[model samples]
Target: MSILFTRLRHTLLPRRNTVARPSDRIQVALLLLLLLLSLAAAAGAILLGAGIHVVESARSVEQTASRYATTAVLLADGPSPGTVGRSGTAGEPGPARATWVTRNGRRHTGDVDAPAGTVAGNEVPVWLDATGAPAERPLTPLAAAVDATAIAAGGWAAVGFLLWLAYRCAVFVLDRFRLARWK
Candidate 1:
């Protein structure tokens, strides 16, 4: 058992002649720098990816809201009321309120009220739920533009980070090769 342990120790220990060469110092420095650069770039890329994900999620929500929205014309010229009413029974008539016009021009009358933004004679977009009820509010063009800009920025940032990482890796490899040749 002692002999076996001695053999294992001898195998694990490094030989004196295997010590790093003079040129290896520069190689080590370059490798350290490369590792740092890689870490920094990875962090930047992760941040960019997260930003992109947020933008995409916003976009998806907007798209889904738009899909669920119904097209309606204002019955009277005024802002929509904040409260909306549901369909009444056969004997009970629905509340007196504005009606929504679908894409097919089908008039659906209901007491469901929307926020005051639409005016009579003005065609506005409105979202409706599965129960044929209004759902989402209006979206401004500025909001959409901001979302697009965020997505673009995130994509560009990710690309820039990857390019920087590539550059650092190339420089590290070239430096290591030069040092090896010098020895």
Candidate 2:
């Protein structure tokens, strides 16, 4: 065992007069910088994605508010007969429009398209907002999970970069020390 240990140490240990090369330090530095930049890029991408999600959610909320104010109703009834040939056009009301029965028994026509497979008398939520928009909802769990993955990847990259930097620095310092001792 002692002989094996001695042989292993001898083969692994550095010899005298071996100096730390400038190229080696440069390589380490470059690797560290690359890792750090990659981490930063990942973090930035996550932030950008989150920002876009927030904007979309806000737009949905605004639409929902508009729908609520406009007293819109989901056409519980199937599409009207005349709506068969109707093409959905912007600002053009279709014949298949659902009527919103207000509390006063007054009915108002809404511009929302009926859901697919909806039969006559299927109750759907009515939006009363003026803009006919739906409210924004929070990000889905899947989206949040993706963001979390990005964050974790960035963290791992940062840790790896730091460890690499420490290792390279230690190697350089030890080499210098050994060179000095030999002198």
Candidate 3:
């Protein structure tokens, strides 16, 4: 492994007692610049992802803090083929009428997504907002982590692609110039 690395390192360095071609030098410089830019972009992407995660987590905590969880009894059968979401996809949970009691002991009835074929009187978990209305569950920590990682990876990949593109274009132009000079 060490020998392989030394060989790789030596391949990039100018050999002694020989003059390197200007075009080769320019290619190497552009490659190094691309590497630097990729590193900088990775750092920036990580920071942005971290900031987003922090903000999202804080908001999740704040929103879920006052909200409480309880069970809602289904008031009807879960959505059937005719009552699927707008896209009309099957197998996905669909909204069904339900009733639940809030943290303040107030009773309320509304719609909640329950698994297909759920029958009336079946109990399902429900999240209630501060106003004591049924609401979506708060964002979980796993979701925040996944969101941050995806954003960071996407940002880094986009920057890396642009830098690579720039490097290729520069090398292409340099090669053409060198060819013209040689002719």
Instruction: Report the CA-based lDDT of candidate 3 relative to the real structure.
Output: 0.84
The residue-by-residue lDDT of candidate 2 on 41-138, one tens digit each, is 66675676666556655655555444442334454554544444355533332333566665445666645555444555555554443433332333
TM-score of 3: 0.85
Ranking by TM-score: 3, 2, 1
RMSD for all candidates, in order, please.
15.8, 11.4, 2.4
Question: If scored against the real structure, what TM-score would every candidate get?
Answer: 0.34, 0.38, 0.85
lDDT of the candidates, in the order given: 0.57, 0.54, 0.84
lDDT of 1 by residue, 30-141 (tens): 5566557666765665576566566666766765655566656656644324433243222221222467865555678655443354455545556775456676554444
Clashes of each: 6, 23, 0
- After the best TM-score superposition of candidate 2, give how far the Cα of residue 15 lies from its true spot, in angstroms: 12
Candidate 1 residue spans exceeding 4 A from truth: 1-18, 69-183
- Please write out the lDDT profile of model 3 over residues 68-95, one tens digit for every residue: 7899999998866545565667756888
Residues forming the 10-long window of minimal summed lDDT in candidate 3: 79-88
Best-matching candidate per lDDT: 3
